[model samples]
Target: MTTSQNPTAQAPYKQLRRPTTDRMIAGVASGLGRYFDADPTLVRVIFAVVTVLTGGLAALTYPVIWFLMPEEPPTAPPWPTAATTAAPAAATTTPAPTMPVHGDRGPI
Candidate 1:
């Protein structure tokens, strides 16, 4: 199956960044979610727990990511074409088999 393109696909990976829209606090979790190909909510929950356990030291790291991570441009979906839509039907059709000649016999 074809995979969707992400910011990493288009640009070089460096440090992680916060996502602009998906973020709950500072978008740090959303940025990590994009990098790791995971759900944003999961990352947020983990970070929240870490912050609580660390007595807010984990929370302090967020601003550093917020400043270091590059902003990702919004991606546009690929436009559907008639050929793309019809590809599945074409792929399902069977090809005709050729009969083997006596002298040219090989594995069927």
Candidate 2:
């Protein structure tokens, strides 16, 4: 039976994205773990074994995936956004303090 016809059918998994935290290198293992519903430690152990057994070919391939794989966007922190962020008007009102040109001697 087709999935659409079945009322119990679940939606397909989302595209893989590297997580922002709980990662040793690029979060590839953790991302894979989340996708497959597996333990990340197991994945990391497997990767390490494969890399060693294959004379580090997997090591080189890891960076390739890191470069290609999209990282997950950072989640908003639970903080007072208004107090942390400066308003555009307030920024314009206060000019940044000028530094003395040519060291601390104020203008040589």
Candidate 3:
């Protein structure tokens, strides 16, 4: 007996992008996996097998896709720094505490 999956609901449209947050190397496999909704490990295995089978021709696609696929946007905003955030109110400069003079010795 053979079972066929009926196409019912459509998957949401996703851009072909290299994920910056979750990636191993250039993110090509991860990106393709995410785009196709498949396991990234499976994608990598397939990629390696194809690369070897195709005499490094498939491997060349890695760099090409890396160059073409845009990196996904950063998820979290950058933390506020001293320069970027508002500065505290400036306080008047205070003089250093004076020590009592000693007769050719140290502070008395």
Candidate 4:
């Protein structure tokens, strides 16, 4: 049996920029989180440690990123209410025919 592929499967990843909110410092962690799909808290923790280790040079670096990085716009919901409220179309009820195998096709 052949499987149907989704038409929207090839959509590209959205470009990530700095988040506009939830920032304690300069939103640098949030920007990195968006780019890498990682937790912002973890990024912040690492940045904090690095800042300490580097004698607060990293503290100076965050503001530069804040100034340079663009802010991300808020994302919208995937579907509209009309689409969600409509009843789903009925699915085909016919059973698929089984394929006959020839000889030994080792552990297919």
Provide the TM-score for each candidate, comma-separated: 0.53, 0.55, 0.57, 0.53
TM match of model 2 to true structure: 0.55
Q: Quick one: ranking by TM-score, best first?
A: 3, 2, 4, 1
lDDT per residue for candidate 3 within 1-108, as digits (tens), equals: 998864543335557778776689988898888778788899999999999999999988888899999887665233224455765546445677988676557656
lDDT of 4 by residue, 1-108 (tens): 999976545336665467666566666787787577677899998989999999999999887888888775555223223456676656535577967678857686
Best by TM-score: 3
Higher-lDDT candidate of 1 and 2: 2
Which pairs clash in model 1? none
* Top lDDT prediction, candidate number: 3
Better of 3 and 4 by TM-score: 3
- Residues 46-70 of candidate 2 have per-residue lDDT tens digits of 9999999999988988888888888
Which runs in model 2 stand beyond 4 Å of their true positions? Answer: 1-12, 76-108
Model 1 scores worst on lDDT over the 10 consecutive residues at 72-81
- The candidate, 2 or 4, that scores higher on TM-score is 2
lDDT of all the models against the reference? 0.70, 0.73, 0.76, 0.70
Residue 15 lDDT (model 2): 55
